[model samples]
Target: ISVWTTLAALLGGMLAADVVLGVTPAYFFAALPRAVAISNLWLALGKSMVFGLSIALIGCHYGLRVKPNTESLGQGTTASVVTAITVVLLVDAVFAVVFKNVGL
Candidate 1:
């Protein structure tokens, strides 16, 4: 779902930009392959997948740690949210460093 949504947003934005710039669909399609390489596309998809997986795992882990009390539930939820954000940022930083010259 995340991959599909990202692709949709990417293509939609590209199409909108082309239309606004008075570029035809044919020209847009022709330029797209050269505009973004396959490796870059795969990198984006892989990052999204990792982010999604980390978030899901964190949520599930904290969720199971929750007790029957409301307090535990609230604390578990807060911890999960905070941890997920932190993990995503760290993962993104790692990716940036690792792929610094990927498209260069």
Candidate 2:
């Protein structure tokens, strides 16, 4: 949950920056319209939320299955970390592909 929250906050900051950069009249008029910029910001936020929630839920599920033994706890922690990282990377790649194809 902490990881997801952090990721979501980071993504929100990125989207905010993108919106600022996109709204400069120079670029706004030179490239896509303002509505498109706003839409993109919303879309990015939505994607980030979805990815964050997915990783958080997966982590929680795996974490809840851990045994009380130290070894089991350690292993569960490791697995959760790996799963979260993998999911983050996979979602990033998917976003990259989608954005590239969409000409964003």
Candidate 3:
């Protein structure tokens, strides 16, 4: 899913820049430090995988804590969403900090 989305983002962003911003794909990619593109791709993929895992884990945890009542289900869903978002942000921050020197 991340791969497909990333690919789509690349293509769409490239086309949008070409049409709307007058930036060619070559210039877009060339903006990165030479040979840093692949590392950036790997970094994005790794972060996405971690985000997916964290969200899934949070969802399963909250889901398992729900009682049979509708109120419990609603509360569990809300908690799951909140926790997932929080965890994703934390993970992203950690990734940013850890990769501060990466691909530089």
Which portions of model 1 miss their true places by more than 4 Å?
none
Model 1, residue 18: displacement in angstroms? 3.3
Best by lDDT: 1
Candidate 3 TM-score, true structure as reference: 0.84
lDDT of 3 by residue, 1-104 (tens): 98999889878977898999999889987874464557888898999888998999999999999999999999999999999999899889989998987776
TM-score of each: 0.90, 0.59, 0.84
RMSD of 1: 1.4
Error of 3 at 26 (Å): 6.5
In the predicted model 2, the residue pairs found to clash are: none
Candidate 1 residue lDDT tens string, 7-63: 797789678977788777777778877887778878988999999999999999999
lDDT of all the models against the reference? 0.89, 0.72, 0.88
Model 3 clash pairs are none
lDDT of 2 by residue, 1-104 (tens): 54566567655655665687544544434454533555555567777788879888988988899998999999998998898889889988888777764524
If ranked by lDDT, best first, what sequence of candidates would result?
Answer: 1, 3, 2
- What residue runs in model 3 are displaced by over 4 Å at the alpha carbon? 21-36
Which segments of model 2 are wrong by more than 4 Å? 1-36, 101-104
Instruction: Report the CA-based lDDT of candidate 3 relative to the real structure.
Output: 0.88
As a whole number from 0 to 100, the lDDT of residue 44 in candidate 3 is 89
